[model samples]
Target: MSYKVIVNATLAKFSASHFLKEPFQCSRLHGHNYYISVEVEASLDENYIVVDFIELKEKIKIIAQSLDHRVLIPELSSDLAISETSESIEVVTNTNKRYVFPKIDVILLPLPATTSELLAKFVHDKIKEIYPNKRITIKLEETKNTIAVYKSN
Candidate 1:
């Protein structure tokens, strides 16, 4: 049988901004206090545990820290063109909207969108990179009522 270890510590908090390309209010840049939860599925090891909760939490915390307090930009968005300089990053959208952010304040991700769903997948992938033999489920809460989940099995 397999067991799951869950971690949802308050330390998994990040403040980041993103904008959707859809023609809506969300298209404008906005920030969120995102919360992340991770579930690890594994068979009991010789230690009689699915996985070490402390190790999992620390790994996830590292991922959160990389994105905390920054603007998330989707590097693969065809509708957006990104140019980087030593001091800043320039983003020009297909609609001709332009935004400039300091290089120190941005996190350019290899994703197509910056929505919660995609963020969950990104977290899942990052975890898998560290624990390729384990199954992982990631839940990313964008707001008090909105959450997106991604699973790897």
Candidate 2:
């Protein structure tokens, strides 16, 4: 039989800013208090548990902390031109809109857009690194009514 372990502690959350390339309203930069929940499914190990709850929570916390209070940049976007200098990063959109942020306040991700679905996948991959071979699911709540879920096959 398969067992599942889920971690959705209060600390597994972050506040960050990001923009999408579609839907005019979302194109404008905005911030959100993002909540993350992770679930790992696996057969029981020697300990008769799928995973340790404390360790899972800690891993999720660390992932959230890395994104806390930062501007997330999708470095792989074709519609965005991103340039980095000694102390700052500049982003120019295909529409000629530009944004400048301090280098220290940015986290460049290998993604095409900073959408909730993609972010959920990103978190799933990070946690998968720590618990390889297990089926993992990640849920990212961008707002009270909007949430995205990603699952590994």
How does each model score on TM-score? 0.96, 0.97
Shift in Å, residue 143, candidate 1: 0.8
Which stretches of model 1 miss by more than 4 angstroms? none
What is candidate 1's lDDT per residue for 54-141, written digit by digit as tens? 8888899999999999999999999899999999999999889999999999999999889899999999999999889889999999
What are the runs in model 2 whose C-alpha is more than 4 Å off?
Answer: none
Who wins the lDDT comparison? Answer: 2
- Candidate 2 accuracy as TM-score: 0.97
Candidate 2 lDDT over residue span 1-153, tens digit each: 888888873559999999999556989999999999898999999989899888888889899999999999999999999999999999999889999999999999999999999999999999999999899999899997899999999
- The pairs that clash in candidate 1 are none
At residue 28, what lDDT does model 1 achieve?
94
- Candidate 1 at 144: error in angstroms? 1.7
